[model samples]
Target: MNKTVIIKGMSCRHCAMRVEKALNKINGVEASVDLESRTAKLNLTNSISNQQIIEVIDGVGYEVVEIIDV
Candidate 1:
């Protein structure tokens, strides 16, 4: 499964990489963050909830704008 996470308060590549690392730490999740789009594209190899995804981003000090399934 794949999803897109729209995030707020990310200003540069550092911020983007931070979020990317945080999300990637989660089991069964792979993410790539794009600074320009302020988004993270997520690939799930196992069952995962949107709430879990949101919390990971939030725990890293970023606001989650939205999550869309794709």
Candidate 2:
């Protein structure tokens, strides 16, 4: 399964990488963050909640603007 999360406050590659790393720490999740788009593409092998995703991002000092299953 895939999910696209719109994020805010990512100013550069480092910010993007931080978000990517945070997401990847979650079990069954792999993420690629696009700095230009302010989004992360998450590939999941098991069930994970959108709220969980949001919290992870938030914990890293970013905001999850929206989440969409794709």
Candidate 3:
């Protein structure tokens, strides 16, 4: 499954990278963050909950605006 997550508080590539790294830490999660869009595109190799994803991103100091299947 794939999901596009709209995030806030990412201003540069480094910030995006941080979010990506944090998310990618989860088992079976592949994350690519786009600084320009303030969004993270996630590819899930296993089932995961939206709240779980939200916690990871928020834990890294960003706000999760929304998540949608893509």
Clashing pairs in 1: none
Q: Give candidate 1 regions above 4 Å deviation.
A: none
Stronger candidate by lDDT (1 vs 3): 1
Cα deviation of 24 in candidate 3 (Å)? 0.4
Candidate 1 local lDDT, 1-70, one digit each (tens): 9999999999989999999999999999999999999999999999999999989999989999999999
The C-alpha local distance difference test score for the whole of candidate 1 amounts to 0.96
TM-score of candidate 3 on Cα atoms, chains taken together: 0.97
Across residues 1-69, which tens digit of lDDT does each residue of candidate 3 receive? 999999989988899999999999999999999999888999999999999999999999999999999
What lDDT is reached at residue 26 by model 2? 99
lDDT of 2 by residue, 1-70 (tens): 9999999999999999999999999999999999999999999999999999999999999999999999
TM-score-based ranking, best first? Answer: 2, 1, 3
Worst 10 residues of 3 by lDDT: 8-17
